[model samples]
Target chain A: MSGLKGWREIPIGGLILDAGNAEQYKTGSWRTYRPVWDEGKCIHCLFCWIYCPDSAIIVEEGKMKGIDLEHCKGCGICAEECPPKEKAIEMVLEGEGKGV
Target chain B: MGKIVALTGNDAAGTAMVQIKPDVVAAFPITPQTELMHKFADAVADGEVDTEFVLVESEHSAMSAAVGAAAAGARVMTATSANGFALMWEIVYIAASNRLPIVMTLVNRALSAPINIHCDHSDSMGGRDAGWIQIHSENSQEVYDNLIQGVKIAENKDVLLPVMVTSDGFILSHTLERMEILDEEDVHRFVGEYKPAHTLLDVDHPVTFGPLDLPDYYFEHKRQQVLAMEEARRVILEVGKEFEKLSGRGYGFLEEYQMEGAERAIVALGSTAGTVKQVVDALRERGERVGLIKLRVFRPFPKEELLEALREVKVVAIFDRSHSFGSFGGPLFTEVRSVLYGSDISVEVLNYIYGLGGRNISLEEIEGVFSDLQGVIERGGVKERINYLGVRE
Candidate 1:
């Protein structure tokens, strides 16, 4: 409901002309759990960057920046995709500071 | 402003394409239809017409490319037969829903599995509900004329729907006939320039072509298509009238042949209508009260005209070339019968499935149906509603 519209507010053919406008909405509010990235334990393999459906993982110069919470729905996909035994990422309850 | 020439229906349609000189033509080769695009490609190679010819890998890609060109607001066209049209089935709906006025020359061939490569209405009939303006041609002349007018009818501001001009495969597509070709200038004047209302190539406006619509606006968009179809009826007739001005050949949603003051009639489409007309003439010479209804437009099914024309006819039968298996009868039969529902008119409608896989329908076979109608008229009831014409069983 954020800048996007239902059919009633669209043209006959429903064309989305305003490019990159989906990023305006704060979809992170929908997530009850958010992924906490541990900088110390992080290997920055960028598994989350490759698998984010919404392009929610922030990447800079081919390296993982962090989770882009503005568009992330907090699916904990990054935690699941983390490397074995490293446990570089953990999902924590919303507004509970750091999971570590 | 037209030249008389001998050409097959496929070439005639290709001749029309050459005159219209569309911006892009994306197509794949299939029987009967391949020659139509071959002629178009020849025109492009010989510098007769300036066109970007795309030899796509498959019919699905053919339609996909055609849809893309159309969205970019280019005047585009293509040709395909049975299985090729089936391959294009996915984008067929998308082209219409996107409201692109892309015209296609659909040479009708029987759908495969029993593996047919010959004439039948099943190809176009299969895509009947695909939201495109469908025009049926009776002969080479009609094929050429319909394609030209088809371009206009589809591009009409009110219509803005894709159009499929069909000619029966091999029968009309390969059979050579004498026809008049309109002058390139006259065709250019009539077709004019295509101006899409909303083009994907419009950078300033930046309108998207295909967008996902949830339930909220989907119904409204579909309703708009219904309205566009409603407008198409008027546009088709108007374009036909305009075409008549140049070529002296006119068109209508459905054609009534010797229907006046007649108590009996045979209805059909494509080249079979030509054979039926000859039989009707012979029957009339014997003082028979038989007439013929050659349906030209199947979609936006001419319900009113059909009802009004058949109101007084005591007995009528439709020669359907394609069978709608598991249904009551063939595609044309189901539709023509649907319009005559609840009518007080005592019209005994019969459906005859004929020419499934290029089965030759002789004049004697056509006369037999008329004779059966005569018997039904005299006896007051039909023996079987749906019957096969020439199959050995």
Candidate 2:
């Protein structure tokens, strides 16, 4: 978040100053849809984490910690990639209840 | 603290590499440029240097490996000419954008269609806008000297951009020249060690290189590279001064011969400057007031210096060895004319694109160029701006 002034403030190359700090970018603002996860149906296949373009899926200690909404761009990739008979992950409008 | 040596341009560049002992060298063979890498390979085999040589299959892989090595905090060197340089086009921009201080010896040659292995500036000129600090050399000595300074200039924190030292292919690359090579210790001291500001191998402080930047930050990052180029102009002179302390040669944005109180002058680059200087001297002896400006650095184009150099001249001729087809003038001419725009300078400037594809540029052609300048001055204006010299009509 610091030193994000004009283009001059960035380091000489495109070196990211805040190492591994993609969260600061707040990419979630770019999302028009949100993904709701049902832990009950999760097989922990981690397919959503593997498919995430922004690495926005949160995985902690051999268990899925749901989605990291801070960095997720609401691309619906996680829900599309979720593998279950009924689909554990579903996409929904920002103000709407979790869609089927 | 120097010794006189008879060496070709390629051998001299190889000598510089042997002296510097860069951490890694990734290069492939191209005519006129191949011998340089051959010499380096011999150096490595002979244990003259411990440089890690990546024997890449093509110039593209050569440059790609160079980018990887440079990003990993290793000082890297490479060499190529013409088509080979063209092959490295992709990683060339990435290397500069990633702020890797990769030093390259770009043997100037024409691109192919008829396919020739000879001298021309088309190769490097095509790469002129690729964000590398370009320094042209007139001979083997300049090639050697420029490489020594290029390392320091590119690695400087304020700059941190790639630098390419070029000499005319075959004309300088193969021809023998008398040179005063500095003591190995002196060259080593002058080049110093390349300490990158941030590198991939710096595991303690991890860094991402060439990250995708959207509209929110892409424009600003490019602006920083622009500022770095401006900063390089200052660092180049500074590093040249430091190199002068070790070796007697002082490098600058451009080299001026005569024009102290001249009416007309010729602007050129690379080894052709030597030939132009000879013509200038001959014309001067015959009471012709002509001078020459040999552009050494073309990337951080010395506009202000060029304006100052030609301030007293009445008529100027800019000769480019490369052609920018469908354009008003060649790359050098286009940039030079742009700088003089909107200025109050009372100088008539003309552009001449010649010697493409290693065409022989004789002294007669040189004299004819001066005669045309005289014609332009007498007429008080020029009808044609871009003219070719020595081409069959």
Candidate 3:
């Protein structure tokens, strides 16, 4: 509420006046759980990359690198879609060791 | 300055619509209002206008498409009556809240439970608080004039709220009468082209409309609408004066007829005002002190003008064509009474709900209302505040 706009200061008609302002919103604050990647157990099949709902799974040159915590809502779709045998991606509680 | 021709209210509205040449029109057919769109469709087929006519399956979709077009920076218009108006209730609010200037012709009709399809104020009266400027008409002439003027009022930069120009269903919609129409070039110049400040089609500066307005700012947006409505009061007058220059007939929040030294008056709206005016003239000839207050605009409830108009009258009867159902009196009655409550002038006000489901109120019945006002004056007070006019009971 401190940074929220007043009725007159804000744009008229409840319109979002700027383009590509989604990054400024930082919806990552909504996450309560974080995904942890096990690089050693990784086959890099890229299933987790394909399954990330927020497009938070960072990939480069057709290979999975790691998860981008800036967005990642911790939905765990990547963890569930990862191969059961590999189990390279795991869901962990937020604020746990290296889980932030 | 314009050509005089005989046409029904529907045709007159269609003629005005063709002259305005809105960029888009989305509508569904309904009783009374059906012929209006039919006439516009005929115009579209004949290539008289270059509007994109979207034939939607339902009134809901019609309003939805109108909102989309208006948000996309197109001049949009539509028409509906009664049940059709009821169907479009959701998007109707959306169009106004989004501050889109979509003009709609609301043919006044009875809302159904008994499934009646004739003239009544139930439909538009129910939508009085929907954030749209409501301009009521007394005849085909007003129907034609108000529609053209509605465009300028709705699109006024200071007031970008949607406006509904209403005419009585069947009474005005079906009845043919002589009225003047401005030249196509004159109308085109009067309304000018619609240039919205922000639009969804602006590619360089992309913007989102109708976003989720949470508690943080919902109240503020609503306040903005209130301010716009306040501005509309002045704009309606300015536009009316300018329109009078072109058409020689002026308009305002309400029209006062024969109020000079009047002891009694009747307040009403729509075509019923036409009947009341006849009664006022006949009564005036007989040397009876009576008058008629024809309320043309009901949205911005003209408190100051009404107070001045009713100053000299001792007692007044407000004729409402629809009922408020379980309320103490009809909608107009309540509002008019409230306006006079704290004023320095003390005028006894009575409520009469009449003509529901298109029940006709004859000239004699109107005279009887004035006579009833005489009785209230003689009795020194109103025995019954709420009276049903022409009802069987």
Candidate 4:
């Protein structure tokens, strides 16, 4: 809040003049649980990427790279939708691991 | 000057909408307001106008679609009354807070519980504080004129807020009256082109709307709305002046009838003002110093103008067609009194809650109000702060 614009300086009509500024704000802090992706048990079927509500699943060359935890809301949809056979992703309590 | 034509209030509103030809209109049917939409929709279907008429399932969806279209930077319009307006209540605030210049016709009707489709101010008064400029119409002509002016008022860059132009339900909506309507080309010239400063469709200058405005900046945005409303007072008068030039019909925040040298007066809104005008003329003929201040614009509250209008008056009877339950007085009464509060004005004021649920406030009742004001002056003060008119004992 240190240099936040006052009412006079801000854009009229409460519009965010900068488009796609959502990335500048992180939603990961809102999470009570975070999704953990296992590299070894991965099927790379890309189900987690497809199910992420926040588009937090990072995909490179059409393959799952890792979770973009900065944006992940930890809704457990990625974990819930992961095939039971592979069980590549699991929900863990937030702050359980180092930088989890 | 425009040519004279006979039209009902709904038809008059529809005529204005058809002429303005907003880029988009999302409509759902409701009493009083339905015919206005029908007029616009028929024009769209007949290829008379190129307005995109979206048939929404409900008033909520109607307003949501209107908001979306307006954010995309299209000139948008919609209409509703009573419960339909109530249904659109949530999105109505969203439309205003987002600062979309959407012009809507609110044919004033009673909000439901008993559910009667007739004329009343309950619907529009319910939205008096929703950040939209509220303009009340006395008759069909004003309904047509206000709708045309509303577009310009809402789209004014200095005041880019939604405006709800209201006509009393059924009283004006279903009643035919002779009024002048401008040619489509003339209306086009007056309203001119809508050049939105920022739009979702303007990819070259991208922007976002309806973002999560938390405590950090929510207060600031609301402050912006407050300034915009303040600016609207100037813009509404400016537009009214420009419109007067075109149509020869002058309008202001409030229209004073026989106010000069009057000691007692009645202040009111909507179709009741027309009835009150008749009483004023009758009383004036009988050498009674009674006048009226028919409030044309209510949302901006017209505080200074009202003070100026009521300056010479000693006793005032304010007629509110809607009740503010459990409050000291009706909405108009409280507002008029509040404006005079802490001021040099030492006028005696009274509130008469009248015509609720579309009960007729006849000419005699208006005269009775003036008589009551006369009695207040005779007695030197008010006995009751709030009184009901035209209701059973």
lDDT (10s digit) by residue, model 1, range B242-298 = 888888888888889999888889999989999999999999999998899999998
Residue A65, candidate 3: C-alpha displacement in angstroms:
4.6
Q: How far is B43's C-alpha from truth in model 4 (Å)? A: 1.5
Candidate 4, pairs of clashing residues: none
Answer with 2 or 4, whichever has the higher TM-score: 4
Query: Which prediction has the highest lDDT against the true structure?
Result: 3
User: Which scores better on DockQ, 1 or 2?
Assistant: 2
A best-first ranking of the candidates according to their lDDT comes to: 3, 4, 2, 1
Which regions of candidate 1 are displaced past 4 Å?
A1-10, A17-34, A37-70, A73-100
User: What lDDT tens digits, residue by residue, belong to model 3 across residues B63-173?
Assistant: 999999999999999999999999999998999999998999999999998999999999999998889999999999999999999999999999999999998999999
Model 2 per-residue lDDT tens digits across residues A1-100: 5556787556767787568776566887787888899888998888898999998888999778888878888899889988757487888888785542
CA shift of B275, model 1, Å = 0.4
Please tell me which predicted candidate would have the highest DockQ against the true structure: 3
TM-score of chain B of 4: 0.99
lDDT of each: 0.88, 0.89, 0.92, 0.91
Two-chain complex of model 4, DockQ on C-alpha atoms against the true structure: 0.74
Each model's iRMS:
3.7, 3.0, 1.1, 1.3
Candidate 3: which pairs clash? none
- Single out the weakest 10-residue window by summed lDDT for candidate 4 chain B: B113-122
List the lowest-lDDT window of 10 residues for candidate 3 chain B: B205-214
DockQ values for all predictions? 0.36, 0.52, 0.76, 0.74
